[model samples]
Target: MISQVVIDKVLSKAQETASHSWEYGTVFEALLEYRDPHYSIFHDPFPGGKIPELTVEGVEALRYVKPFIQTNSARLCEGNGSSSDPTSLCIPALLLYNSTTSQAPDNPYLSAVNRQLHDLLSTTPRYSNGAISHRDAYPSLWADFVYMVPPALAYHGVFTSDIGMVKESVRQCQLYCEVLSTSKGYWRHIVNAEGTGSVKSDDGAWCTSNAWAAAGMARVLATLRKSQYGSETADEQKMLLNMTKGILDGAIEADTDASGLLRNYLDNETWFPEVAGTALMAATAFRMALLEPGTFGERYVGWATCKLESVSRYIDEETGVAAPVVNSLKEGQRTPLNGINPEGQAFVVLLYAAWRDRRTVAEDASVPMAGTDASRT
Candidate 1:
């Protein structure tokens, strides 16, 4: 288990980093040193200059990301294009919304953006519809983007107490699963709207995509279980459980590396070293399993805990961050990739929070031993 002090330090550093990216009322795309830092829609200062203002959702994103972007005020507006897609913008907005203390006001613009996102999901063709359908768009192919949207949408639904929103979120999750599931109980790295699969150019399974699917399903399931609407039907519950099981089973089969950490690529051909994204994805799945304890809950919990511990061992304490330390022999044993991503940090925070909450409940005896045992090793 990570000590409180370490957790605090990491949180503090993340928060500090988040602050640096804020400027002119917007958070920059990233804090990579090569990127421009001083830009925001609010204070373009220059007339007809290239950078545009942050969208309303961008403003919303800042509410949560402010801590990390505060110090990097100069870079917020630099790279952002004038016309940003609502889907791409929704993530930071939702994160900001979730982290903030203020209640989401019933503003028309916010409502419109919410409705727009909903429309996008509804109109998008399902994988069952056709391989070249609308769902096979840009974000769908990218695991990171595809996985990020659901939690935000679920949070939006929960916060607004909108049953339709919740259901829509679940449906999108199902769609994602249907499109990604492999014949072998694994998920494909790239999927088409019609449910066809794509192989990585390198002939490897994208570990992060599978991880994202696993984590996304677990989160969606947890959210649905907590909703009053979620309790209305046995069919709903059964479907959710089945989906959860499928994802966990696939993740176990496809992603687990020899080091107990999940690999970023796999093919029964070779084991690649673990990536932080995959580790966090696995951690997210494990955390969700703990959140909703059941028959498969203990298995997910154990898997996540072990994966997190192994991954955490490589974290650079001096930087209060994690970096990839393992590489796949298939890739010729190259050094692992390293970076501190907000998504990764967010998952860590979530994992820590889940662990803390469970510990509290166990100490208080509110959670039955059976449930605890089922949730943890």
Candidate 2:
């Protein structure tokens, strides 16, 4: 397990480095769900504990994240462009609405949430097959969009009891997987499906992109399983679980160096071993293990432990920055060995949070429940 001191340092550095972009949004979600369990959307023991009265960390999370949501909710309501990244803010907006005391129909935050949702579903550019485009200029698909858009849509579906939104999330994931997933089980980084976009298609299976897809699938699955819609979405959940496992197992198999750290590009050993993707991948594995201990418990959790240990070696004790990552903003450029970013820091916390949850559950399961035999053997 990661020490509390390291988690604190990473959070501090992440806050310092994060901008009002997707990176910051990633950090915000990590802090909200994992670090501050009070605000987590998933059920207890899956990611966070029960929602309780605001704690100090919870208050800090609100203080830090509320401004971003408030400021962008209004701006994004304009539906000006095709960038899907800002859709991430919708989750935080819905989370805020859920926690608010006055949930009246006229609530400004609620209106903001509706507007953001409208912009995503109605204004966003999508392909003929219904896959949402990642960029504004053309019909492009990015592995990162799996994390940025679908999970938020699913969560909104849960809050509003909109089964259609949930189904749309499932459809989006299926379309993205069809476009990105290779026979090898790894997903390619980006594709300009229409070929008209200026964005280049990245053929390499970038490690972080795969991590994003897997983690997002896990989040969507969790939302479905824990929400009132779980029974109806059972088949969809199974599909997501299988897809997530395929990506994870493929990435793990490609770690030929036995470094527990994957290359920046999973198949290209020429690139540097990276920490950000490794952490997120490990985090997702722990989550998968929690969800399906009978199928994934032993294999996924064991690998996740090894990967987290490897990731810890890269963290600077003084600065808490995980290093030697691909430049997130320049992923299509094939750049490697960049300085640490906020998402990298956030991934570390996510990995640790998953590990901690796994450990706690294992310990709880080991002890005898009330009126149960303590030592039958």
Superposed by TM-score, candidate 1 places the C-alpha of residue 201 at a distance from the truth, in angstroms, of 8.1
**Count of backbone clashes for each model?**
30, 0
Query: What TM-score do all the candidates reach, one by one?
Result: 0.65, 0.89
Model 2 off-target regions past 4 Å? 45-58, 71-82, 101-106, 332-338, 366-377
Model 1 Cα displacement at 96 (Å)? 7.3
Instruction: Tell me the tens digit of each residue's lDDT in model 2 across 138-189.
Output: 7788898898888888877766678999888988999999999998898999
Best by lDDT: 2
Tally clashes: model 1. Answer: 30
Q: lDDT per residue, candidate 1, 1-377, as tens digits?
A: 56656655555445454322112111222221001212211112112321123433434334444433211222212213111123434434433434334335742234434654554555544344322122223323434333445644664665566766666666655665566566665566654332345623232356655555666556566555554445653464566566656656666766546666666565453545664445545555544554455555566666666666776675566665755633221332444634454344444544555455444455666555213643344
Off by over 4 Å in 1: 12-63, 66-112, 115-146, 155-162, 193-204, 254-256, 268-271, 325-335, 369-377
